[model samples]
Structures are given as structure tokens and as C-alpha cells.
Target chain A: MSFHEKSNLAVLALLTLVFGVYFLWLMPQMAVADPLPPPAAVAGVLIPFVLCLVVLIGVVHLVFKLRDLKEKGEADERDRLIETRAEARAGFMLALGVFGALTLLLAGAAPFWIANALLGALVLAELVKGVLRAIAYRRS
Target chain B: MGKGKTRIANSIREQRFHAGEMTQQQLADAVGVTRQTVIAMEQGRYSPSLEVAFRVARVFGKPLEEVFSYEDEA
Candidate 1:
């Protein structure tokens, strides 16, 4: 695999693992709550989660760069095209997710639920983008 | 009209063979693309842009028409 493909795979794996654990922990609390958990409680979890994710992703990319020093170059035309197409599709996914979150808000859902819904939408959109890019790279 | 049904066909592989058995990576470097892009083009799974087409033709010292041909699948 090219360095880009390998890097993409690594990032995708990290996103899945990190967010998967986060949602698994948060979902149970959400279900048991009347409307939503306290914002402070959610923020407490989120701050650390974001910090850890950034650090982990940074380390992963550093390792990839170190391993593939020769493969490093600016993205060429094909790479740009693949990324553009993937982001376009992911944009649609984000739009759909935002619409759903807005509907929840209209129904008088808690701020916590809306916030999480938006966050979930963003994460899912990113996942979709990553998967599509991977497929494009494979087929290319 | 469908995926993988591109009307454009290329003689990149044959040209590469004539050009001293040029490796895909070498051609890609000459044309400023990734080796995977070169592979995709050779396999007819991808169609490059016009600029890239010209670049590839130039790399092999051939006209664009000699390198790439269009098939009217009407």
C-alpha cells in the first residue's frame, strides 16, 4: 500500500476504536437518564476524550511518516479528486445528520441529546469519508 | 455511462514496454502521479485528466492520440 493508504487505514482504525468506546460508555447513561445527562458530566468526559484522540492520532501519523519517509509528497491530482469526491458524499451525510438533530430539537429534546446527536453526525460523516476514500484508493 | 465503462483506452503499458521496459513507478514519477494511479490507468479502471494525458504522452515522446484513443460505444 502507498503511504497515503496506510495512513488512512491507521486513522480510520483509531477513529473507530476511540469513538466506539466513547459511544458505548455514553449510550448507557443516556438511556437511563430522563432526558439527558448533565452538561458538566458530558463535558468532563468529552474534554479528556478529545485530548486523548488528538494525542493518539498525532502519534500514529508520526509513526507512519517515520516509516515511509521516502513516500512523502504533496497529494497529486488523483489523490485530490478522490478526497473531493469522498468529502462531497460525506457532506451529504452531515446534512442528513444535522436535519435529524434539528428535528430532535424541535421535539423538545435536551441540549445534551442535541449536542451528542451533532457530535455523532460529525463522527459518522468522517467515517463515511474515510471509507469512501479507501475504496477510491483501492480501485484507483 | 456506467462505472468502469470508460470509453477512453490507453496504450500506456505497451508504450512503457517499448520505452526500455519502464517501470510503473518510473512512469508515474515522470508524469507526476502515484504508481497506483499509473496502475489504475493501465488496468482501465481510471481515466486521467487531459493535463495528465498530455504529460504521459510527452514522457513517452508520443502524441496524445497515439497514447490514448476514444471508443464510441454508441
Candidate 2:
């Protein structure tokens, strides 16, 4: 795999782990049998903490890998083209998600729902960009 | 995945072999590309831009047509 593809895979794994831990494990555990669920402020702090931890781990791992390879990181023309196309697709996905979030807010959805929707959209956009880049690398 | 859909084919691998068995990394360094890009071009999985194509041809001291050719699929 190219460095970019490996980097994308690392990021994808990190996002999956972070979101899975936050949504499926942490959030559910926080509300179990509790009459008063924790405030959004608690969630906000914990989520950022978890995200930071995961991102740090990913950066450390990538750094080690790069050291082992002894590669001076540089993207060539093909990489640029793939990134350009992937970002274009991801940009559209992000715009649509943000618009959907706005619509939900206009329809009087809860603040929590709007926030989650917007966050989910942002994550999905990054995920889409990574997935499309990996696919383009393979298919091309 | 098949040659039918391929728009271009190249003899980079053969040319590199003739040029004292040059490594893909060497070619990539000479042509200002990543080794992975050179690998893709050699495998006919990706076509380079016109500028990159010219660079590759120049490295091999050959005409562009000698290194790459367009294919029209009917």
C-alpha cells in the first residue's frame, strides 16, 4: 500500500474505534438505569477527550511507521489527483449533511439531535474521503 | 480490470529493464513521482499525465510513443 492509503486506513480505524466507543459503549453506559442522564456538557468533554486520545495514538503509530520506512513524505501527481477527486465527493456529502442538520433545526428538533446529526455528518464526510481515496488507489 | 477498458498501455517495465535494470524507485526519483505511481504505470493500472509521460520518455532517452501508446476500445 502507498503511504497515503496506509494513512487513510489508520484514520479509518481510529474513527471507527472512537465513534464506536463513544456511541455504542460510552453513551449507552452513561444512561443505563439513570433517572437523570448526564448533561450534554459532560458528553461534550468526554467525547473530545476520547477523540484526542485516539488521534494521538494514530499520529504516534503513523510516525513510527514513517520512521521505519525512512520516507520523506511527498505526494506525487497521481496522489494529488486522487485526493482532489476524493475531496470533491466528500465536500458534497458534507454540504448535504449540514443542510440536513439545518433542516432538522428549522423543524424544531432537539439541540442534542442537531448536534449529533452535524457531528455524524462531519465524521461521515471524512470517512467518505478516506474510503474514496483508498478505492481510487486500488481501482486505478 | 481488463485491457478492453484501458485507455493507454506503456513499456516502462521493458524500458527500465533495458536501461541496466533500473529500479522503479530510481525511475520515480528521476521523473519526480512516487515509486507507487511508477508501479501503477508499469502495471498499466494508471496512466500518467502528459508532463509525467514526457519525463518518463526523457529518462529513457526515447520518444513518447516508444514508451506509451493510446488504445481505442470500440
Candidate 3:
């Protein structure tokens, strides 16, 4: 795999693990919590989640850079093309996610649920982009 | 419209052999692409842009048509 492919795989794995744990913890609370969790309470989990994601991604890139010190990290034409294609598809995923979030709002869902839905959509879009990129790299 | 698989074929491997067994990395560096791009071209899994195709041919001192060819699916 090229450096970009390796980096993509690492990020994909990280997003899966981080968000997987988050949703697992949050989903159970959604059913039982009366009045739903406050935004501050969600932020309690989200703040840490964002922090961990940012730190871990930084570490991943740092390791990759260390492993390939000579690499200038410049993306070539092929990399740009693959990324553009993946983003194009992922854009549709985001739109669908946003539509779902809007639907939840119209149905009188809790703000907590609507917020999480939007977050889920964003994360899912990113995951789809990563998967598409990986596939493009493997097949082409 | 339905998309068809890439039908562009290249003789990068053969040309590399003729060019003193040039490494994929060398060709990629010379043509300003990644080595995986070079590999994809050699395996006929990817079709490069016209500029890249020209660059690759230039590196081997061959005409563009000599390096890459297209096949009609019909």
C-alpha cells in the first residue's frame, strides 16, 4: 500500500473504534433517560471523544511520517483523483444523513436525538469516504 | 449510462525492461506520480490522464502510442 492508503486505513480503523464505542455507550442511555440528556451532558462525552480523535489522528500521522522521513507528503494526481471521487460519493451520504436528521426534527424527536443523528451522518459519511478510497486504491 | 471497465493497455513493464530494468519507483518519480500508480498502469487497472501518459512515454523515449493503446469494447 502507498503511504496515503496506509494512512486511510489507519484513520478508518480509528473512526470505527472511537465512534463505535461512543454510539454503543450513548444508545442505551437514549431509551431510559427521562427528558433526555442535556447538551452539557452530551458534551461531557463529546468533548472527550473529539479530543481523543484529534490526538489519535495526530499520532497516527506522526508515526507514518517517522516511518517515511523522506516522503514529502505531497499528493500526486492519482491521489487527488481518488480523493475527489470518494468525496463526491460521500457528499451524497452526507446529504442523506442531513435529510434523516431533518426528518427526525419534523417528527418531534428530542434535540438530543436529532443532534446525534446529524453527528452519525457526518461520521458515516467520513467512513464511507475512507472505504471508497481504500477500494479505489486496491482496485486501481 | 453504464460504465465499462478501463480498456486502456500499456507496455510499461516491457518498456521498463528495455530501459535498463527501471524500477516502478523510478518511473513514478520521473513521471511525478506514486509507485502504486505505476503498478496500476502496468497491470491495466487504471488509466492515466493524457499528461501523465505523455510523461511516462517521454521518460522511456518512446511515442505515446507505442507506450499506451486503447481497445474497442465493441
Q: Which residue pairs overlap in candidate 3's backbone?
A: none
The C-alpha stretches of model 3 lying farther than 4 A from their native spots are B1-5
Error at B65, model 3, angstroms: 0.9
Chain B only, TM-score of each candidate: 0.93, 0.89, 0.90
TM-score each candidate: 0.92, 0.85, 0.93
Q: Per-prediction DockQ, in order?
A: 0.49, 0.49, 0.51
Q: How close is candidate 2 to the true structure, as a TM-score?
A: 0.85
Error of 3 at A131 (Å): 1.2
What is every candidate's alpha-carbon RMSD to the true fold? 2.0, 3.1, 2.1
Select the stronger candidate by DockQ from 1 and 3: 3
Candidate 1 per-residue lDDT over residues A46-67, each given as its tens digit: 8888888899988988887787
Q: Model 3 misses residue B6 by how many Å?
A: 2.1
lDDT of 2 by residue, A1-140 (tens): 66776777777777777776776776566545345343465476566857685776678667857675755457888889899999999999999999999999999976655776687788889889989888888877
Q: Give per-residue CA lDDT, model 3, range B1-74, as digits (tens).
A: 01234788889999999999999999999999889889888888788999999999999999999999999888
Q: Quality of candidate 3's docking, in CAPRI categories?
A: medium
Cα lDDT tens digits for candidate 3, A1-140 = 78899889999999999999888876566647887887678878788988999899999999999998866677888788899999999999999999999999999998888889999999999999999999888877
* Candidate 1 ranges beyond 4 A from true positions: A30-35
Error of 1 at B55 (Å): 0.6
The most accurate candidate by DockQ is 3
True contacts kept of each: 0.48, 0.52, 0.61
